[model samples]
Target: MEGQAKGLLKLINEKGIHRNTKFLAIASGKGGVGKTNFAVNLAYILANDFDKKVLLIDADMGMANVHILVNVNTKKTLKDILNGERIEDIIFTTRNFDVLPGFSGIDAINEIDDSAVYKLVQNLNDISENYDFVLIDTSAGIDNKVISFIRASSKTYVLTTPEPTAIMDAYALIKSMKKLYDYSNFKIVVNMVKNEDEGIETFERLRSSIKKFLDIDVQLAGVIPLTKNLQKTVKKKQIISEVYPSDKFVLHLKKIAASEVGEPAPEIKEGFWDRVVSFLRKEG
Candidate 1:
């Protein structure tokens, strides 16, 4: 099945692998934020609609389930790559994209070391050279594994919902990441929204919280509304965008993807210190 999927991707494009690749890391502060769902559908849309060569790296490592979500069986995973295995042995194809499956089973994830992380990043960088985009589906929660994937990527997205806990955790994750690297390339996506106004409200609240406490600015890439078909698609192991192309939810997601891949991120303005000083001076 995996090989057949690869053949499909190859048939979609006769030119073989692409040389320019963009890495987009999908991350969240906690589990159950639908990060994987977003990653899966986004990759599918890029592959099907945009006809781009995409590689979905299930960087969630220990708890990787991108394959399960899509109901595809992978023969090899990153476990072999970390154990002195050649990278070529682990790459597989999906229905619409290529996937570098994460490690599975028996302490494979727990045994990962700095050397493994380095090699993983290096291998990913090399693979990116041959694809149009590499969508990294990072593990939920603020673990070292998640951080490694997010920090290594060229772009990172923080996903949140209208739920209070989810929003707070998302903010926390953003704050923690900012401590390690510049958050300029970070963007937000509010998922499972009830309506457009609810989505905007959620974004505004989260943005305000970050601006107030962390004094960091974030861009809202877009929002995904909660639709019944989302669950149906997941149950069927299909992408909402593909199964229901005409669905409003899918259309909005396509728009988000278009903006995401169509342009480079705008330059982030001013350092946190500058923002703090400005606020203090204004108050005085």
Candidate 2:
């Protein structure tokens, strides 16, 4: 199995990475590791630095807080879509990108039945076509909802810190990615690192473990340093990327935006949203 996996990974590399990546999921194995903050800043960098039309979807469900980070007092969400509001009406525009704020009352994802899923999939597809990138800030941990989003997305960037627990949970998340989703191609963002060496070591530790156990492919997207008054900026309800464009962490984000991302230039596996539509149809 390990040999076969290596052969498949070699073939994937020989074919080059897929370029027409439309939906990207930013997720974590545990909360409070700055996953949402990373997603928000990545969207900003992709839009402002790379000139991509980006949409950041706050898909954290019951713990939605992208609005708080961006200082947008949003009133409508997926719930409002059921009340006859168009998805376009619920989107809040920002300086660099757009946001579809998540619903934050209870576990709203459970309340979304097949009909609601169908409605959301349709509206989401319609709106998503206009943008170059759609970043879903998924809820943390190995929750089924998070798995579904990661499964549906074109790319998954698992966020982790240098903390031992974060690394352990990140490996667990990768295991679930392969076990539950039958997916293993993942990009890792080691955030809040003390230095470059620490970041590289952290990624290597996670990678070696994953290679020994999961036999999966994982790429280091980039490393964010523990620089700047990031928490203070977050408290101001502002994105650090925008607030401190010259910060080391923001520069690392820019590096990821430029190197890890590209225009939708190549053909991609189409009908992902349609698959969701079909699932909704079957459920209904």
**Highest-lDDT candidate:** 2
* Pairs clashing within candidate 1: none
What lDDT would each prediction earn against the true structure? 0.75, 0.81
Error of 2 at 257 (Å): 0.2
- Per-residue lDDT of 237 in model 1: 81
Candidate 1 global TM-score: 0.79
Local lDDT at 220 for model 2: 94
Query: How would you encode candidate 2's per-residue C-alpha lDDT over 193-247 as one tens digit per residue?
Result: 9999999999999999998998986889989999757988987887898888999
Misplaced by over 4 Å in model 1 are: 1-18, 104-122, 182-184, 265-284
User: TM-scores for all candidates?
Assistant: 0.79, 0.86
Candidate that scores best on TM-score: 2
